[model samples]
Target: MNIVHILKKYPVVILLLLLTACEEDGDKIYLSGLEASEFILTETDILLSKENASKIVLSAAWKNNTLVVSNPDMGAPDVFTAYLQISTQEDFSSNVIETEGTGESKAYTGAELNAIARNLGLVPDVATPVYFRLRGSIGANMESAYSGVKTVYISPYLIDMTVGFILDKDKQQTGLTLASPDADGIYTGFVGATSWYNFFMEEGDGKIWGNLAADGSAFLASSEEGSWNFWYPEPGGCYYTEVNTVRKRWSAIYLPALEVSGDITGEMTFDRPNTRWYYVFNAASAGTATIRFSGQGDEYNYETGDGAPAAGKVTIAFAQENGQLVLTGAAGTISVQVPAAGECTLILDLSDPKNWTCEVTSGSEEPEPVAPEVYVIGIDDGITGGGWNFDNKLYLYNEDNLAYAGVLNVHSLWGYQIGTEKDNWGDVYTQAGGDAYSGTLEFKGQNNLAAPAPGVYLFDVSLKNLTYALTAVGDHVYVNGLDDKWEFNQTLAATSVPGVYSGSITVSGASSYGFKIYLVQNNWNMLFGGSDGKLTYGGADIPDSNSWSAGTYTITVDLVNRTYTIQ
Candidate 1:
């Protein structure tokens, strides 16, 4: 090196010498101020749910999701962003869907960060429940799955849900019932335990329609008639039987839901507008995990077709206690008007730092049981519809209990008049013989001891609460007060006037046989005379019949004419 270059560089040595002599810039010391000892990562937990419906909510929580870096001076976190990652048990692979996309980081403050994590998509509509996961972010930093990944548990829900399932009571709460299919569902009568009744439905045309038959059953309780004669005449003695059938259908069907709730879930309600769906579902990532709700409700007014609007406001009565979100009144007891033709859904903002969030799942389908047909026949058949002719006064007495509630079947049919036509099905009434009106119960006349088959059998006996009166005539006794015509075992005949003036009647059947007699008024009314004065009905007897049965022909006095005649 040159001495000049060395002198230039050595200038600092002379400067240092001068400074050292002055003691001002003698030596320079470097020191650093206190740096933070440690940075701590505070942990936070959250849950999400739906609102409104009876269902609980959708949510899951875990404190391990966040890491604690332990910087004592580090106060509560300022910004929190959550990156949600989701996967199905089928595929553990991690990736974001296309339009379905991945969950971007959602941010929150310290206060709001400690609570719930409901996303807007958690709102329930007509859609079903789907599964997914969530991951969180802090400030501008990203947290890997190992740092913060959470799986969620969700269920079906709605704004306001109530149950109606029972079938035996006037009011339904929970029991067996046929699932309502739709507007076109028919009112079918079937045989149930309660049995012997029918249900009417308001049809589209505004008319009420009824269905009934033998072997069929109903849910409503029924009336019974005492034992009389149950018989068939062809190549037989007494063939006794008594069969029962009843069927019914409900107007509005109801179902319940699965409930879920936690501090982190929100309320769920019905009515949803879909650009396509209420919440979009993500397959690969937690694209859009959605809890859904199902079932139906309507005021006196009802809707039947599409979906409701997303922006419209729902009139929900929110109760702070239990977080009740009712579409009706505050007590949830009020009835409102339902739209004429659409499905509706209400969405709640769950992504915000609300104390709760709710996610709901819709409903699933169930299969219904198959049913059988029913039949009712013979005079006094006790049926509402079916082709029948019961004008013949030949009444039956099957050894079975009889019914006389309100009006009998016979009188109800009188309103139809002779030859009066109606649907192929006849009016309510009873018939008298074999295969008559396709009946479930048939009464067979007995001869020897084999007490008829037990349980319920078809009977040909009917009529109650009335009686037929007649003294006697010279030869034949009249019925219904009309003379000259007679019905002998279903065969028609003409007779001469009796000398006695009692109510004229035709002697039906052979004089030697014991039988039941009635002045049948239409199809439901009947009057008789005997030991009980109530009468020996159907085919069953009082063990003795000589007095009630015909013997030696005799004369009788005339009550109206004050005259007498002998045979």
Candidate 2:
């Protein structure tokens, strides 16, 4: 029985005995004892209003109700340390402020309590109640129960200001000037009263002019009326009004009106009897115009008809010449051609009791012809291999057929659609049958076209022809195999020469693995796989009968020749 033999046999027994000895000697032991009793607070409720918040002090005092430890050797300290906690919530879950107690008393100055109220996000002039409690501790890990909760009602201070609206010398009172106790006292309240008058505020007196800051003033005007001028203390600045003709009101701000100058063109046709026609044109600098005729009217009615003339077809032509728009047409076709000056409407009074009269009415112009806008559709989902990002949008490649073409990587069964806008699904093109991909694509349909297999397929969607084609790649080729960890990430890059991609890769082990050539990395929708060293677009996986042994292989993919070699 040597020391080594004895220690190996009784290691656990020896360790337990040593721990017991140390515990008995009080080296690392703590004697269990009863906890301190709950404490009692002197005040449980307090009011901290804005009136008294600046003058009074917030204080709380607590008394220890439990019996004190009489033995000095028990390792308990006299006079327990206490902490006062203040919080906005009743449970004090967060945003709590802790204040240490001076013996049994804790005090907060008026300014301190007000800061706490503001930090709790209490609105000015609004009253909010906060909670407080005292927690006492004797030593590390020894805490007495919490004292009763106390509440403090606090309110913030608010400022008061006066606002008024002054009327101009026009003697037109826009509206009543409202004076209220709870008003926000902003300039919007004054200008919002009426749409005709512009309001401004002066510092000393309302009658004084040029004293008001331009930033502090606001104006209202009508939309139908392009520009208007109003006088405040001085002449209110001339501001273009944005008048809402529908609502018969204007915005609170002023904007300049846009001046337009251009030639106007329009057409008119007479089809019924006793029908009056009126048109207006705004000539910028007087240019030539062409008015062609197509329909004919009864020439006899123009000379004999009294009130409510009989229906007739008329041939007419209008041209801007000699600084005037002249109308030249066959007689009994039109009564007048020339129009009055100034922006006015040409009134063709066919309702005349004796004869037809045509004259200008007011001022206007015929709108110009606008060009059509072109919008490019976008490919979304797994089709683009970039998810549904609009930055990778597709465009119309062939206008004649109305076909949209873009490079896309399709999964075997994953579906996608074309959208009018990027990242927006409100308008899209889907396949017919609601769940099948056939026939033609419909707007906002439920079904989407799926790829026949996993690979990269060129998408040619023709809306005009109502057909789509998925062309596999024989040129822009890619190699996808076990070397890519069977994922899209490890695709081998190919060298482009003429019409084919050729590259070489090293096979590391003799373990069983399969690979194929693809047009896109990680895209299994279209691939080239075949037997007897022959590669075809969208064919089966290669090496049909046997697996290639571990070795470095040089491969050449010839899309022009439609062949491949491995050596």
Candidate 3:
């Protein structure tokens, strides 16, 4: 290779670099002047218009501190195809108030979408200092026409009008304060989520207000209310079918899958797990009523008329073992398990003699679906002694007491242990090496061990592979997961002193996993520390303080066989 040849190769590389120049491209979407698209808001702004629309306005001040925004057209039945968007400007990236059409918002009809976004005191609706924007599109991909902005308001923050709150379980407060800069800032003339489906809100007294939209106004303010349950989406459009005895016995549940005129079709259902809805009529009842949809757009909606009941109505949302999902508004719960495929259904329809006979009211608010508390033993009912049928739990159980609060578990298994090491039978018993933990394994639900208990206790920590211990005392409890080194089950296997449940021996094993453990005064407090366990009344390390209180105190054994232990 000659030096001249090398120089020629270098020149070729230089030429390539010169031709390759980095280019940049950028485009922005501002709701401004997009076209005459749809406009969605939660309020009509009693401050702006004399009539408080079910939803039409957004306003706030720094005083409100909290950021607030929602779908402009929430709870209206126009089927408007607008999304609740937000930004400092008309652009997409300017700090959004609402995420574009996720979850229920995606398939919401004009009214459904509006109700979701505008529901007062709901999540994603009460936040302040939010920016909002919305646009309308036709067809699934929004390929058709778009709408224009009808009215404009300026604020430090604004939430998209297309976004609204669905008054499901999480936001079921008795009376949530809708923030307002001044009393006038947030006009409640429009009914909040409570009266949204029933009445229109209008400004009445100087301070108080009343429901007014029901009288031929605000989308009929339909007396129709739907129960939140689950069933599969029937292909022939959503309809209400009464459950027969067979269906009730089989625990067959239906979920709903809804398509937002365009975009995506979602299947909706009950919040329970493995739950089924069973509506049974008494044999004496001569008639059966069914809610059917005549056409594709037809829905068994706007429940009206005081209505009449059949002979006997049995509505149940039962768990696998509980009674059928036959609910009559007494006081109970239905456990619905989310299936692996499709959607679930929960509908409330006026049956038989329609005259508003079935007046619907909200049920107990479902707590935010937190991971249920649970307990996991090294033994899984799989191995001979280790396998137990006991289920995971939310709280702890000792003996027979449940409400005592003496529970020492953040997560646990079934409490009622059914079988023995020899038989290895029954559902609650999990086998552990030939020995059974016996007793029902405490099971709350999932991983809700993040709860805190009372009194002072010790914690064990192991990171990477290093082990460390600490003593902590607090009135609250909170746990994330069971880090093997987080805490230990310290209970006495034997006792030297006799206290309240004197002969009670603080047995080893079973304490709050992850975090906090409580000291219930009356119930399991003594039982958990009962029998073989000793309650050392005035000890420095016991659950009872230097002279205790009455509440059931969760006691832990500090030493083993008189061995020198950390007191």
TM for every model, in the order presented, reads 0.15, 0.22, 0.19
| C-alpha lDDT of all candidate models, in order | 0.24, 0.42, 0.24
TM-score for candidate 3, residues paired by index: 0.19
Query: Worst ten-residue run, lDDT, model 2?
Result: 13-22
Query: Which of 2 and 3 is the better model by lDDT?
Result: 2
- Evaluated against the true structure, the overall lDDT of model 3 is 0.24
lDDT per residue for candidate 3 within 1-567, as digits (tens), equals 001111122221211000001112442211211233233333332222112223334431110011111223322122224355544344445444443443212322223333323332123323332234444432253232323322333211223322112122322212222222232323211111110111112111111122122422211221123322111111212222221111211011112332111111222222222121112121222222222111121222123211112122233221112423222323233332222222223232222211101111223222234222222232223223444333422222211111111122221233222221223332122222111211122222222112123222222212111222222323322211122222333222323321111112222333222122222222221222211233221111222232332233343332211112111
lDDT for position 422 in model 2: 51
Give lDDT tens digits, candidate 2, residues 217-278. 22322212223333221111112112222232222222111111123335442211223343
- What lDDT, from 0 to 1, does candidate 1 have? 0.24
Worst 10 contiguous positions by lDDT, candidate 1: 15-24
lDDT tens string, model 1, 502-547?
Answer: 3322332233223333323232223222223233222222112333
**Off by more than 4 A, model 2:** 1-387, 433-439, 475-567
Worst 10 residues of 3 by lDDT: 14-23
Q: Local error of candidate 1 at 196, Å?
A: 26
